[model samples]
Target: MNDAAMPKGPATALEHFDVLIVGAGISGIGGAYHLKQQCPGKSFVVLETLESFGGTWLTHTYPGIRSDSDLYTFGYRFKPWVGPPIATADEILKYMGEVIEENDLSPHIRYRHRITNATWSSRDNLWTVEAERLDTGQAVAFTCNFLWMCQGYYRHSEGYTPEWPGMADFKGRIVHPQTWPDDLDLKDKKVVVIGSGATAATLVPAIADDCGHVTLLQRSPTYFIPGRNANELADILRELKIDEAWIHEIVRRKILHDQDLFTRRSFEEPEAVKQELLAGVSAFVGPEITEKHFTPSYRPWRQRIAFVPDGDIFQCVNRGKASVVTDEIERFTEQGILLKSGQELEADIVITATGFNLNVLGDISFAVDGKPLNFADTVTYRGMMFTGVPNLVWVFGYFRASWTLRADLVADFVCRLLTHMDEKGARKVTVELRPEDKDMPLSAWIDPENFNPGYLMRGMHLLPKRGDKPEWQHSQDYWREKEELPLIDLDDSAFVYAGTKARTPEPVG
Candidate 1:
């Protein structure tokens, strides 16, 4: 392979790389690092649509934007997170930036390159990716042996907001957190925020002091884990002056172990786990408020349980700066909203912190062997590679645990698969259902009963199907995946390797 032969920029010629990673977010950054460190022999490039790195952190500009999951696990396994357990978006971006600077990943990443189409050719064992440079509006192309999709599974252009009657009649501004405006002022204005998800929880407290009155209006209550942001294990390790890397590994393991136990108890001892979670919130807002606004009908862990970090949200509620209203919205009123209970609430600004719309595969049109790819028609292989999709892996993270946890696992899997392909003199590899799995029952990507969020429920039809087997389903259990992903049998019959193309020798300077 010669550097002189690579495509320089926007041109009719396609740049050649051993691997092309989509998105430069946390997953994408980690993927790039893994490819560089584990498979140094492979040439790779990361294409991000945004002007800079940090996919979600860069796109989301809403106040109080922070991670619900702890940074110990949310941060990359190779990186040492020195911040508090819960981190703000700025802190996260700084951390991700350090990863890039430390690893010299900036040169390998091309910003403003929005991939529009990815076509796989079986004969050539290559993927031709088409992209448009958002800055210049010029189209670019790249050819790669493998496509790594780290683009997240959500619509970044806008957040999902349910249409309410008479929204146009309202005299105030209505905004979704995903697309929060900078010039908008909330000072001395009565605000109403809709939805009970993490976004709502994060926003209410963030703007409570500035707003005249902020109310969290939810149709139903959701579970929350209100606690201190500090991790006791990390605190002790720091006191002992232990190495930062050692502390990170120790705290990460402790958190994952506790999370697994808590998740298992949510199903095994639903009543007990529910009471424990309620007690945590009750400690801050009291039993009445906890039962009325924090108690959820479903068991704990059904949906994500956000960590409140020093009970910040509850503190605002306790001090009378913010309030919670549990009722369905009948329609929008001239001033605010009309509830089903015949109550009218007044508001000057409405923030719909309602979830995001799922965008599968970065909303890129994909094709295999010249046929359009209908993801719903295919079944996921361990929630990464799909049936009949060759030389590609989609990094879909976990639901219960931190997302980067699985990202690291998938990185290792991809690196291993690439190395194995090189050793076998193969250029393409696709996962197919084994003969024994041909008749297995198939269902939605994720079971509603296990973990059903509004966004997932609304976009389940757009996702791929999943089989009953462990290898076929995502099995969002990070604790198990951390142990299993490393030991996966790459030689299993489920993996079909093809094409006898040998690796090209590197060119001398």
Candidate 2:
């Protein structure tokens, strides 16, 4: 916590700032950097619920918790990532810490400040944010001219784990990776991990040697890209004695360009892309094993493709340290899990690597002018701002590209919007549907046909709607957004700016 920026008023009094940023994670830190660099005059403070920074990386303590996406693109654009493409949780934390230290961001960040409610006052052109100190249990109030939400999309307190029948009867311990116990003893323990997502893949290889035997159980197979973690482009650039910053930018752009092509190929040539992905895994596990436990029914990119460095999971399987099982769970038995195929897998411990529960707006209660706000009732403006919401922007990143890509883009947009507001002397800015877009078809936040993750699907009803117009929807296209976002016209009809003209005071006499 930065004592200098700490609220010094009474508990009931409001500590004010020009902008209030939520969360101190990657997006929040990036937002802070952009704000300080671009809008140096604006006063701001960051409120984070966690004890420290590194949101997901700090929260997840499961064995082998690492990035599924390469760090070259995952890392911030302003910062240089010199490590391997695939980095562990500790490495990511170190990288994020460096960003904070290098940029002198610690002074503006207030950790353990959990925002509970936010209310917008249209008349006053401000937002009243209510939070409580996790350490002191004291309520705090804050007023900000604008709100920037970068709290991330999922609940970090607990992971999503489906209840199994007879789970209570099971004698072994059951744990969810999101809340992995620090004292968890896996030595010589026969462990069965549920779900075959990135978490399971990462965990199996990390603990395979310690466990007597580890099994990855999945209801259905999922796609993975298994390859060397090193980035050839970055290695070559380094060998050429290139500056680290230049190497970072060069490698990042190259990876993104290739990613764009791969994304296009996935949609255009689905089967070819699918075969290419499976072939990568087949190199280590053989075609038979790949077909049995690695082949997904859906086409490539239906869900996220976890990247496995050096095919570690398959290597563990070859060494007889780990095994993969593809079957639906019947129920939990006294010994372990009973499969629908009438197979009983005995295990001393069960780890659920299941996904997460989506969190909308940090699950913070929001109100506008004393009226409760239901996010689902509003429409999204490029998936950042809401139709009726004023002076607030949320950072919702891409599903395909690195999340930081969109975060950086949104930071740029917010800073630009803030600067525009200052120039126009406007205090409130809200996005509204234009007359031409009044009859545009409204749909789910995202098109399920395009991308549908389980967490998003479960929480779709709670999210805002999307309109047919590109401005009224989040395209989730980094390639297009990188160009279109900065070019967005703030003076367009979709934007409603107010509080510019000062009201004349009635007779003083």
Candidate 3:
């Protein structure tokens, strides 16, 4: 039903649905597509906060923004990426649009509807979802049997701004990458970029050519690796007249395996290897820049590094188009930024590429019978679903591998679960890992201490232990996921389903 015809205000009774998906991002879309394919007649709807779709791809409009992962692995397996390796934001957005249209998914989406809270009712076995429309500010509610949360970690609509003293007093215009102003002209103007994460590294070199001088300010160091933006392997496969599906599979496997190997070696080898990697970054930036800032005490991959093609960031620094400052920010002055070492640097514009605000589970509060959920208190089961939350599933992909790879697996798993439920006459199903299964050490790639508001941390006790073999393990290996999630049957005793006749009603008239 269209927004005008739908009921307004609080919905007291359960408005039945087979599935209710929050956030229309990659994960949500994947889930919806799989659900529709598996259960054609099932009633489902996707509630998106933004007026437009594409989730992060639509919200993040920062300059030079692009996917860090290669498209061969990053893009959906069902839909081949008919573009360059590392896709730009606009290209990715267009691809998402195409996916929605090609699948005829527009009718299933409720745009501008932001879910505010969801509470599960044990007696009725339903979740009451409360939401508000961004454009109209009118509240609405929906009740569904299954609630799938695909809201990503980053708060796409908001930017993270640290409380730097006298920040407001700075005479120059300050901007954050999340909310970059369109009218602000930085041409021939001195620019100071704060933070050393992916955003800063990418932005520094990108805007340097137009600006007079660009200074990258950082408090700590991050690993800087480089990769080609265009996939040579994909091009070669295409030239060889290989099948499109075969080419995608081959390239995806190769890249995923190579990344896994590199990550393993970084941790398994001696400290010298980590040092050597850091030294390589230092060498690329030159000793003068290295001595001033390139050295970070943490090991490689403690946090993800900012990547570029052919050492672009270093090249910009070497050409004197940009500079680095390792000093801590003391305060912002009317004319410039004052450093802790009693030094100051003047700038016409200040870009706080500091970091993202991680809003885990899309900042939507959840409760079971009015008892609010403390996410930290509950354990994460399979790094996706939580223990104790019934008839719910979540999509959480790799921090190391391409997100879509695992997302595709999770989508397939959901479809399998739905099919099983239908065949067995089950009303609800909830999957949780065994308690003893949480002791295994997780991949070192995930940051344990970094507790930004936007970040999502799976507690040690909540996550499943790594399996002995790669197939059963929580590895980001695509072949492993294909074997474990897809090929495996959904008859495991751990996933209990209530066999009842209370199927979700059709969409409201």
C-alpha-based local distance difference test score of model 3: 0.75
Residue 161 deviation, candidate 1, in Å?
A: 0.4
Instruction: Give the distance in Å from residue 216's predicted Cα in candidate 1 to where it truly belongs.
Output: 0.4
For all candidates in order, the CA lDDT equals 0.92, 0.92, 0.75
The 10-residue segment with the lowest total lDDT in model 1: 1-10
lDDT measured at residue 483 in model 3 versus the true structure, 0 to 100: 71
Model 3, total clashes? 6
Model 2 root-mean-square deviation? 3.9
User: Candidate 1 on 1-509: residue-level lDDT in tens?
Assistant: 33334344645566789999999999999999999999999999999998899999999999899999999999999999999999999999999999999999999999988888999988888898999876666778888999999999998988999999999999999999999998989999999999998889999999999999999999999888888899988999999999999999999999988999999988899999999989989999899988889889998888999998889989999999999999999999888999999988899999998899999999999999999999999999999999999999999999899999999999999999999999998899999999999999999999999999999999999998999989999987888888898999999999999999724324334
Give the 10-residue window scoring lowest on summed lDDT in candidate 2: 500-509
**Candidate 2 Cα errors over 4 Å, as ranges:** 1-12, 501-509
Q: Candidate 3, which ten residues in sequence have the lowest lDDT sum?
A: 450-459
Name the candidate, 2 or 3, with the larger TM-score value.
2
Q: Scored by Cα lDDT, where does model 2 land?
A: 0.92
Clashing pairs in model 3? 357-454, 358-453, 358-454, 358-455, 359-454, 380-462
What is the lDDT, from 0 to 100, of the residue 159 in candidate 3?
A: 80
Between candidates 1 and 3, the one scoring higher on TM-score is 1
Residue pairs of candidate 1 with colliding backbone atoms: none
